[model samples]
Target: MTPYQRWTLRTDATSYTVRLSADGPWAELDAWGPHGVETGPSALDWSHRTHFFTPADAAPAEYLPYGLRPFTGADLVASRPGEERGVWWEFAGAEEDEGALRLAFTDEVLGLRTVLCYRTVPGTDVILRWTEFTSSRELRLERLDSAAVTVPVTGPARLTYLTGQWSQEFQHTRLDLSRGTFSMGSTQGAPGHAYAPWLAVQDGENGPAYGVALEWPGNWHLTAQAEPGGFVRVRAGRVPHEGAVYLTPGETLTTPRLACAFSAEGLDGLSRVWHRYERHLSGERLRRPRKVLYNSWEATAFDVDAAGQLELAKTAADIGAELFVVDDGWFTGRADDTGGLGDWYPDPAAFPDGFGRFVDDVRALGLDFGLWIEPEAVSPGSELYAEHPDWVYRIEDRPARLVRNQLLLDLGRTDVQDFVIGTLDRLLTEYDISYLKWDMNRPPTERSRPGAGPADRLDLDAQHVAGYLHVLDHLRSAHPHVTVEGCAGGGARVDHATLARTDVLWPSDNTAPLDRLAIQYGFLHAHAPHVMSSWVTDAPGVFDPRSRSLAFRFVNAMCGVLGIGADLRHWDADQRAEAARWIARYKDVRDVVHLGEARLLGSPRDVTCGVQYDGADGRTVVAALSTGPLDGAPLVPGRPARLRLRGLDAAATYRDADSGAAYSGAHLLHYGLPFAWSAAHDAELVVLTRE
Candidate 1:
């Protein structure tokens, strides 16, 4: 008889434990929470309960197959070609190395071995979990989840997740689950704007929050089920194709990493845990400050020409922009979005005096040059598409569908991946470019590879994801100096995997002040500010029609990595001077805004909303805005709306940088920062130094 054995994985502030009971063959979660949670009695233990189903079905399993966990949903579902569909696996062995633990299980009848993997992230409350499957014989996996997390909730579970449409991405949503299941996912090839691959769960408003995020960039799903036996189980992983993914002999299939976090201080604290983990993912790249860039997409659109772009670059440089990007229309045949996507060379008609000369001219203005490229897409009218018609995805007998007048190149193919890599490499080599805006304007439509086999056709999503990642990996290694900004028609392909590769992410295309505030408010809950690339655009109103001042726009953009997308050529002397001043002010506080701990003050729903950043070096920066009409009567006759500060040294005193007024930290934390709104002073950028 195998005696009960347990293993504990710990981070600085949290602990996760797994145990194999002497009476059961599967591993189960013992405890998961604050640092000392493993020492207490597990709330998940179901050993004493009487059950009609198998013991493993009712237990808080780490990872169980369909046969053993027939009643409850299984983390893995597999079968042989002509055999039954379930895995009745037995315990094989266990291995532990430095902070990671691996538990192996084998189904001899199916000739398969499965290993559950766990490793605690250093200096964070996040534990990375995944599963590996190896088959001695060929097998089909209908469902292969990365990990199943058992939340320690005694009653109903409140789930907080992110969901929305394209321009309105990252809207926060909440649901309460007492029974049944709740699921969210994306089938749009990339992690679509409809739903993010993340979820946070807690028992009540004040309970500890448990969060999980999948590191997959392709089709994925996250499901939370409040079982009848009184516990919430969250299963997260990449969603397989129409049928199943084939696992041949000796070829191991490893699922994407699932990062699980526990925070006793609720969802806000859980966000900080995710932020630290993201910073760790960034490695040395986080050390470099995200530069202020001016993208010409909004200014000129497809009417891009060397002369016009040069004029914009001059104004951008004058306003203290560090990088100038030519967005779209630069390449040959691309007078508009319909014609020249695949042809990446600069248009001779637009440049007149060579693309190299144009790049040099932009750089001569003391700003680094950047270019936008949508490598995964090709216009039907493009030369590359006309040459390699077979490269784009299509069904043999069906008419090829075009989205945005373009077809998605079959990036899953090695030849297609090589072509993209070559295009980027050659462009980077020829031009003195320091930044690349990699954008995917649309998802793949009619996704199919004509000549592939029955089983191989289903693997298109995974293959494309692998191929996309390979291109990014090559870019990182080949051109380490170049900063890569990831965008998928704005924030569609955002995930841990993409975040690890790109320097920053463009959260949304709608830069209107109020709409962007709400979008960013939701975005900051799951992402770090450093990676959120926000722009100041001349969008009169994309979602909200309310007119906002230049200061309001600057303050809104200042909450993240700042950029200017508005046409600078049209700006008068006063507007340009104000913008230059705002740019200089942003440079002053960007370090604290990017590197500091971010706290979402009052939400966008509140009349007064803001974001506060507390730096490790004793500096605090806050970007406050009045979301509602300033002409409305005050809530209190004589009192100003206050944003109570958080994460401060209550004993110390903080002095305002603008007004030179000093206030005790206790008062700031309790009484909050005061703001009186008007048309001209609807937003404020406050820098506080602790004394």
Candidate 2:
């Protein structure tokens, strides 16, 4: 009754087709994107052709099979209970169910079965793939991949992916596709701060790009290999255990789903596909109004008390902040990082009369209250840790390693999970808290478990991620009104996995605007601006230290969700006035900047550059920043710094919100407006609304 089959799967912009070889097994399928041509059906005979299961002379044309296939890019590799040979899957059947197509393969010798599932969204060119395995007899799997896809392209293809370390995550890198295997993966318990589980492949710099992203949050791998016949194979999955998983009779396992998309419209277009998919899933929250919040870390440090906080709150409220977050050091015995973790209670010294009156006062001042918490760590000096030393990951004889003077609490334990959930629940229920900044400051190390064998230790990494998600999910469900921002010593845990649950991400701990520009630029490439919370902090930059103007800082921070981490109590009267003006300006265009599609023009390395946000309804805003000309190159004699505006109707006219200057869309897109810089480190925000 279904029109789709094993032969073809089609979308509005692309089509995928496969046909059976003479022996009834599928051949290498042909994929057609907007830029690629379609291929004819298979014509090979079974007379002398090699089968993947047979001891073959070449790699199987079908999706990478394990045994006799010469292909190294395999999706499934396993053996039976008493056998030494690899799995040899035989073609069973293919059928369509609802909106999905399933291809089943079986091995009577090993009594193992696999189903290759595929589905295409109704209007998009994305293809979703995953694998399911079932066994009639006990089987052992050494390697199992979630999905494997092959793309037809010759030499000169380039691969692009994101890589960085703590405080500097999401830096984009591109490398030419070489002959051998190039993989980006992490085995350090998490998707890790080093590499993100996403990649894009293209023939060259410009157009016709293919993108792939793995949905798993635990340790994972993605490999792209250049095959012999001008084709490339990509496979992604949870890191397969070299030690094996024994599946009992009647048992079944399903791998994580992989999402793939293709666009002939270049990298930006490919990015748009991902953006659309995320926005569709997030719905209203993706477009919700973000607040201008003031975080009190840089202002007060660990010397926190009710009276001091109240004073800072008054100044923050006076300057038009809608949210006030009291970052670390609000809890029990908390003089420094080494003492008060794991004990999640209001410090008696910091809040002598309890936090109730302070919360009421903050509410009376017309600002929502937020709190910072690192729920997954413990300090050895804390009362809670002293009470429950077994709650953290540790080995029998090894000294527990500490980073940031804290140990990772094994949330994988039910008792630890309950305690975390209970603490967060009580906090949210007892206070007028409107936001929570959930932070994890250190990576997983010393990953051994007491009384557990080696096999169980191998699973510790996955259990930690599972436990973290469970806590996050439970808290969000119980307290739907509160917004949660994710931070891991700043930006280490910023990925789609955490982004899906949290309302915002602290992009970095270093918010000095000059450094923030590049950090934010790299972040926006894979993440939307709405979830990237960039703050205007007082700290000097990591790289540049020329004392940038406050206006430049404000413009750069406004490119994402705006937060102020400055000590407002110390700001001069003139500084306070300028701050108020910029805050007002940000409020006016918050919708466009938060919900609109962002376009970064020129490189962040360029001296004069801009970030533009184009709203769906024809409104636009451009924040142009200049730190002198590029390499001190003199300005053109008659041409100003021209920015060719994008995403405007060529036939329409627009008026500037401030200057009331009129310009045709054609003129703006062609000749561009003359952006004049008065001095070094100068910045200006330009607003244009179509008429």
Candidate 3:
């Protein structure tokens, strides 16, 4: 969606495919073709043809990031380099190593560039980041390491770890990247991880989904997918095969990275249907209006009453919360544990009047109505379960361990799919609900169906995962107007594919200020701030209990997605006032933060984390958060150090987060002042106004 004519960027770990078609009402740089690939314009005729599913085919048509595959004819067999199938998109511009190409598809429909090697031979790594802008932002491949990374996805089906020759897998095309130890060829048992046959990359009604038929060698998971800003990765082990594989020095493992520029859950799953979906995303960018909002569950407990919900909603609307989302606890039989899932109808006992009244009340306060749904989960204790106990998935003979007392519904099955789609479709039409938070609570486990052969080596993980993709796809198409927020045990399934559907995502369940400081730091490295959900919790000392200053909240809220989950209706006057104040402040600058460059001034390990935003007119906002007294000690006595900032307007005026006193960029940054927090003290957000 970042304005580009047509561009393809690929690396050892991933590839990017971007295209610009007819822009509505307005079009900026007109697209020509896949003109920027170094290898030449690839024959997209195959892409134009109805793609057939096979065990092997090495082309990069629906391949992510860029449409270029990592290797082709020459890459397959180093011995017969010239004999390798060569396809070109463009080859017009070149200077030996200059990154540009020409293409036969070089018409007015697309325009793209390619960055073939991340490590143009490892470490003297090549990059497209510093290139001259082509009316589009530059793309780059970065290497972020293992322990420093978190799982990426918005639901339960997520890969805890990943490794590779881990780049591209085009069905039976027999990918062999092995000149410098870059090859992916496994034997019968140790089948390498990959999307079998093909992966469907589609833009659904709400977001995007990379669908795979998922017949693979071994049980696997969708480990990670870091988009836009990109990610650093680790590889998974593959069974070695009989071949002269390539190696990059001592780097023994290899991997194919998931590409994105990604994330989404949609309201109606309209984007899932190929024809309508193609028409939906053929041309467009995500459109959003600024909104202040609040969510429950982060507030009070699961035992929320209509009164409790209404109390929170009142405070939410009063404090400018646009979409009042009542998180969890609305369905019949849903109390603490998820025993009564799939019962979408409201609990008539909880409120004599139904959710219609809840929607009406929220609307009365000038706010939109939002609800949460985990439609993919079915509990053994519910009426749906009593009617169809077999619908719950678990291996036969093995006691089904109650994961939150709920079982994952098989979206891959026709009857199950119909049931889920029916339940959600009815809700969309029945309620005037404007927003939904789609939660997936799936974990890695046995996915035994009613009659699927147990010894058939079914990739239950993959199939269950496929079911999730199907459910999300179906729902998004069903409700296009209802914005969804994806949550997977909090942060389990935070990835690029989910982002295309929903406007925001729950970054992690771990909201401890110190932990979140680093947790969110890594999340932002690959994702836009707007997709993240940030809020204040009981991080002692981050905010004075009676200060009425959401200093910590503003720091977390300002960066990406913003929300306060703690029960606000129970907060003291000061806490409530503080929350309200921070909410208002963000309303003033959300646009600037949402659309600016985010610069990390230091490593997340430091006692203090620094971030800066350089907006269009040179307006800069520098935010810093105190992690904690490093090594269990206080730093209150540390010197008032001056900070030399990056991405700052060296000439802009700066203001203190506390005093509002102004200082020139040169004066404040020149003197390195240590952060001013005691014990587990506060964090700060500073905005710089350029004159």
Candidate 4:
């Protein structure tokens, strides 16, 4: 803990002033921007960075393109004709209610009281909650620095270059109204479209914005607006898209709203976040991924035929996978998607003696055991539904629309909460489950209850908010060592909110690494690599059929979760051997891939992009991407080959990461690497460890 910094939030003409205590742990966090903030002053920053914007800042013509359009001092004054509206300003509203500082602000749109409290938890955390609310839509954020409460916005979403002789970084960040959503953070994208909001940080290896863009704080509750059924529209970066969202008038959007605690740990996360982002943007391949894990969803879906999934798990373990996860379909009578939700009990028919036996088998194979669950949802046919028909969320008497034949259980209700927590508790107690895959398949809008009043008391818009946090808190406490992941209908709800709660975030269901190349690029720009979900991907619709280059498939999933979703059962000896080698590579550098800084060398949408990773051993994983014409074969020449990097140590040894080729020079060079490729192919994973 450093010393001396009292931050006072105030209003300014264009942006806000976040003055840090002169004699503090950090120098100062002063930034003059139109969006959230950025970490670097280089194009490489785009590798691991994202931008933010709100509806308030969108229409302001002066702040066109809301999120990241590069700003000049002259443009600071409100250049648009309209008085920027919406929840435009936020700051420390009240003194600590207990040990916590209580902050208050209005959502502007719904005129709802959005109060938040932050204070150290005696010896542990700095707790924050959005309570004492008139509207059920209270906001809660986590991972805030218990000590500091202010910082400045700079980098990406703001000015491309510093101006007005200003060079203050956010020592502590407080919100202010600007051209877009916040007073100063005009980091907005298309208003009425579905998008996920992202926050980016930088690390080394990945250039500039190539640090940590960690999304999914924990469990998030998100909504777009105050009106019912309005989709939330939050975008990250220069139009690269990640997650599904939209905006409308009726719904109120409530995000995870996590308070980033800037400790030494945060710096590492920040670095990894940017690195992952850069990798995706550059369309680089990974020599290794964070978790040497495998997912069973692709191999078996909800139809978890014991032998089928078991074989997949066996292959994953044999390929040096550290964790084996049976995604979906393990619960009692839940053999398929049509049934078995809400029934937390393990299915004896599926696992015979429950997961305990499977766990023993996987452990014997030197792999950890993991389970999949969607505790927040209940199947209409499940026993829990039969017993507690009133617990599912609904608008009282309105008819329910079932997704995957299930209904959402309201965490706001204690009984529902108890049921979920207890079920999870029983599972942990009964089995040696080390991981949990928390999935929410439906986007809740129309709130309902079996027998509640007509008045809207259920935080309908905040369902995701309250629902997710409740689960996170329980899992964190009851199963302290277990790793939890947030997966919402693939990658729809991936944002900073859920990042705080879980260890990782499953980016999306689209496993085609090429598509994932774009998806991961967009996701990394705003979230952390530790949690990005992907697999030894396959094309979208094709099943049991024509195989694309397995190497290309390997390259695609290498950067993310780095597991195989393709039916390995169908793979013969040669293909299996190749898959094993890829997994072996991932096992070698998985730590660096998951934790090191990432740099996006080029645009994923372009004909070329490359991802590079740096390690202590001078290890680097460079994934080069070429969209059409060239397959990800190696070294295609004639295409522009000069590579610009971000977040590098700048003075490290170098070599041909793949071919053992040598480079004779200083690690830092203004001209970057030579312009050449092995051959113009689709993708290639180039690994170079400095000897």
Predicted structure with the largest lDDT when compared to the true one? 1
Residues 563-603, model 3: lDDT tens digits: 76666666788767776777777776676676565666554
Candidate 1, run of 10 with poorest lDDT: 631-640
Q: Give the TM-score of each candidate.
A: 0.98, 0.91, 0.61, 0.65
| lDDT for each residue of candidate 2 in 1-691, tens digit (9 for 90 to 100) | 1222336677667766554443334445545465234554322112333445342223324454567454465566788756775767667888875447788888888888888888876656677778888999888876677787666665756888888777566777888875777888887556767887888888767757888888766678898887555556788888732345567789897776787788777676676666655555455676567899999999999888999888888888888889999999999878988889988888888888889878888889999999999999899998888999888888788899999999999877778899999999999999999899999887677766676555532456556777888998987789878889988787767556677778888877888777777777766666677887988878897776656778888999998888999988878998888888999999999888877777776656766778788886778998887765433233765445766776678999988989999899999889776676655437888999899
Q: What local distance difference test score does each model get?
A: 0.90, 0.76, 0.47, 0.49
- lDDT score, candidate 3: 0.47
Q: Give the per-residue lDDT of model 4 (tens digit) for 365-481.
A: 777788888877888888888998778766655788787677877666767777788888988888787888887776444455545543333334344356557777778777877
lDDT assessment of candidate 2: 0.76
Q: Which parts of model 3 have CA positions greater than 4 angstroms off? A: 1-257, 260-286, 453-462, 539-550, 628-638, 649-681
Could you tell which candidate, 1 or 2, scores higher by lDDT? 1
What TM-score should be assigned to candidate 4?
A: 0.65
Error of 1 at 34 (Å): 1.1
lDDT of 2 at 488: 79
Q: Where is the poorest 10-residue window by lDDT in model 3?
A: 143-152
Which portions of model 1 miss their true places by more than 4 Å? 1-3, 455-458
